[model samples]
Target: MSSIPSPTLSAPSPRVNEGMSQGTPACPSSCDHFDLDYTRQEDVRTVVETMMTAHQTYHNRMHAYFKKFPSKEAALLKPHPDTTKEQWKELCDLFTSEAFMKQSEQNKKNRSKLTVNHAAGSRSFQCTRACMKNQESSNINPVELYKKNYTNKDGIWTSEGAREIYRQCDLEGKTYTEIEVYSEILGKKSGYVRGLGRAVKPPPSSTLTTQSSDLQHQLAKARDEIEAMRVAREKDLQEFAKKQAEMEATLRDHREEQWVEQERIRLEQEERMKMEQEHMRVEHDERMQKEQEHMRKEQERLPVEISKKLEKKMSSVMEKKMNDMSKRLFSQFGGSKK
Candidate 1:
């Protein structure tokens, strides 16, 4: 039997001259240089580009092969597209809208941190306003109340649980703003009412009962004192208001008197101005009349002076004409005698 021979591969064409330019000598026919990779590189972009080129070549070849053959069974064997275009578009739109809403809400919350609850764990730890106010009125520190009521086995306080315990407790005197600061400081120092953790055992039931009774008595006493103070404050306010009314009346009367005096002074000033104006007018008229009379006299004197000047001119002209005529007649008689 005859053995089939493998095909021989040719080297790059001499016309290409790429190897010659690089000064690389051509190899012998016996040498197997084809198995070796002479231009391998570790560059990531180069590797990726190589892979993309191979994938594209393979895809084009497969596409052409499939188009030529047109096999229904092979087409069925391939996986279908993950989703339709319309479905994909709808999902992207939904995600965009939801993500935008979430971002907007976060930005809004960041902009307006309205309450103390904006602090971490503060919502579940800080006492309610009403509870704080009540405890503050009773001269009980908020921190102490937090410890007595909310502290669990682990020595942590929860704001939600404190409300029920606060209801059973009694109240007393007026509360001030400073009380809250004091309570917060005490709570911090005690290290009991930490935000968002379990607390240890609270006060015993018997102690709570005793405290409630004492608080009740104190509350009644405080109420009576507050009532008396309110009555006294009301009386003082009424007296002050009455005095203010009287002072306002005096001020109004004083203002009216000032206005009347000002009006009188203004009227006198106008009268003085009017008289001065009238005197000035009379003076001006007299001066104008004198000036007119002087002008009339000057006009009367000017005509006579003008007539005298004209008579002088006429006499000089007549005399010169008579002299000329006499000279002419004498010259004529003399010529005739000669």
Candidate 2:
């Protein structure tokens, strides 16, 4: 048997990966290269986030906040209590209750009913209008074949024309008895509710009340505002009282600090005085010893008569030292001898 010719390769190497050709097509390798994979992964995460329990983070972190409903039955029928702080992590089953599901279902049902009654009704009406629009001919509706002879002038139909107009669109489909009954029902124009042209009558008090009631309402509103202002002022006064107490406390603290500062200064002055007194006492003892030695030196160097006179002066000097010696020095501190 003749062998079929082998297909020629496009290139020495394959253009596409053999692995890609062998397996099911994956999100492209370029997806990973261009970070599209990570982005798609995040998109998937976002979808999971919406589908999973709201407490997923808390579950993952082991920091769950527990919420409870008034009753299991009530929970099923209504929304659970507002989200709150939970001290401990709990089993996911605790939050999954039949009542919760029932309540969620009930809520969904109520919403569905509202949607059916209002939204669906509106949608149905819209669809019907669309169908009517599509079906409607561009031409104006022609007068009924029997009433073709009737004519309207200045775009206004006369009473005869009006009666004939309703006959074709309204009375045409009804039975004789129904038409006879409906014929008695007169059409009323504007400025009338029951075809009697009687709309509203003001009561004797209504007009009077209307005129004065506005002023009365204004006065009442003003009074209410005044009362509200009074209450607000009272509340402000209470708040101000707290602020005033705080201010007084701060002032008291400041005064205590001032007193402490003054006491510290007074003690410093006392300490300075004590140190000066101690210095003066030491100087006095040294001066007395020097004077006694000087008297002895004078007796050896001078005549006996001069030495005796010096001894009398020495007693006077001793008395002067007692009177003149004091704490502190300098010309500012006046002494009896100086």
Candidate 3:
């Protein structure tokens, strides 16, 4: 017999093979590469870049201030010179402050992005107005931005996010900065341009004075809220304890009432049974006494009846004997006469 030809499996097309080799399908243009609200940790490079920008802006403002007020005896001259140790410490505090940072964010939101070309004559006046506004804005207090931003689970500061990503990717033995660099290389979107550092520059003496007052006010408010919460918590605990005690007392009283009612019913039943038994005993005793009396009367009547029968029999016997004697005497007398 002849065998039929076997069918062969076909290979995949060249385009399919090319896609498989490339490891991933190409993205369509409609698909966005950058996610504005990405959940990943912000990159260190972005933080560094933002810091550099803030520093440059601060430098420019300082140059403009000196140029406008060339004399050393100017009113805007601060107690501590810029970039000094004391000034740097204050700068750090200013940047870390929550209220000031929040105000900066709000200002960013409110301000127009478009740059306007103003005349040279109006530049100095506008600059002065802006400086005064910054001073007024310093009236807002600072929050713990550093603690909030760096300490949480989603934080990348101090290389936490980098370390986590590295662990997930099976990488080991890298410093924090190196891990961040590797994370970027892995095609992860770690880069960000949000408000990374303290957005506001350190203010002069006039602004610092207002900022200090605002800080004190915020601290006081926080303390008051904490105290109020403590008092409310204590009150709630006391109320709970009071309610528990009342419930226990009510239960106890109800149990006692139930026991008392059961005891009363038991006593009543016992007394009723005792009275019935006593009544039955009295009735039985009376019946026995009546029967005994009837028996005694019957015994006395029986003896009297026996004595009467005996006397009648004796009298009959005497009468019959006397009649027989008389008859014999008569017969003898008659024979003598003959």
Candidate 4:
């Protein structure tokens, strides 16, 4: 049986290496190199799982925000307030893609089937292993690491499956390496290492010298990408600041215009009220003058009417007295003649 080749100096220790024949089941290159620490935690599983959770949450939030728009076209036209136009357009395309939708649905189905959840809050397995190595001065066995991550402080297994796997993988005086035991139980997975987080890429299946060269190249590429991203971020921040200032200035100008318009309307209303009051005062004065003129004419007509009535009554009384005096004189003369 052909033995597996030793990894580079940067790779994990030989204890984690799979010593199976070429035909036999073997773990990925990432499983062998436990040296690379992707997270602060020694527990690789917890860190990987936490990262997965955060990635899913970010996508979910983005999808939810995307749904707020009427359509993908509309979303693309109006990018998110926090993100740049290019970033928003890319996200819009991703969210609307059929492949992404299918993957999201499949992920939902897989999540629904899960029965037991890990008790570790945000803590990871890498951190746990680091702590153990610090205390024991030796690399922690894979089985022990699994138990520590799954089980509570009381040493009870988290689930029946976990307990069964632990019992089966327990060396128990047998001659099986911890890596072999884990590979047999967990089975082989493509791409990322089984326990390690996705952030850690699997080493290439090549010579040690070639692997070292490739790693150096990858590191250089990553640095370049990081620098580019930093520059882009700075530019985006400057643009965002400029846009914010412009928006504030526009809003301030709009408010000032509105204030001026309102003041003009208020002044016009005040002037109209004053004009109406003056007109009312003028009309009231004219009415008072007309009333005074009518009262004076009534006074003059009343004296004239009273004087005419008295003269007519006196003339009628004098005529009746003259008739009586004439009749009395005629009667006295007739009696003397007789």
**Which of the numbered candidates is closest to the native, going by highest lDDT?**
4
User: TM-score winner among the candidates?
Assistant: 4
TM-scores, in order shown?
A: 0.29, 0.28, 0.27, 0.37
- Candidate 2 residues lying further than 4 Å off, grouped into runs, are 1-205, 300-338
State the lDDT of candidate 3 residue by residue for 257-322, as single tens digits.
999999999999999999999999998888888888778877887787777777777777777777
Name model 1 segments beyond 4 Å from true: 1-227, 318-338
Worst 10 residues of 2 by lDDT: 193-202
What ranking emerges by TM-score with the best candidate at the front? Answer: 4, 1, 2, 3
Q: Mind giving the per-residue lDDT tens digits that candidate 2 earns over 284-306?
A: 98898899899888877688767
* lDDT on C-alpha atoms for all candidate structures: 0.49, 0.44, 0.47, 0.66
**Residue range 238-258, candidate 4, lDDT tens digits:** 999999999999999999999
Show pairs that collide, candidate 2: 65-86, 66-86, 76-99, 76-102, 76-103, 77-103
Please give the TM-score that candidate 4 achieves against the real structure: 0.37
Tens-digit per-residue lDDT, 1-338, candidate 1: 12222222223244324443565444212122222222332133334544675676654444444344345344434422553555444433443466755975796788675321212222233233223323234244544545544545465544443543343332433343433333333233232223211121122247877997798688777887888898999999999999999999999999999999999999999999999999999999999998898888889878888878877777777787778877788789877999
Among residues 3 or more apart in sequence or in different chains, the pairs in candidate 3 whose N, CA or C atoms overlap within 3 Å are 97-142, 97-143, 98-142, 98-143, 99-141, 99-142, 99-143
Error of 4 at 5 (Å): 25
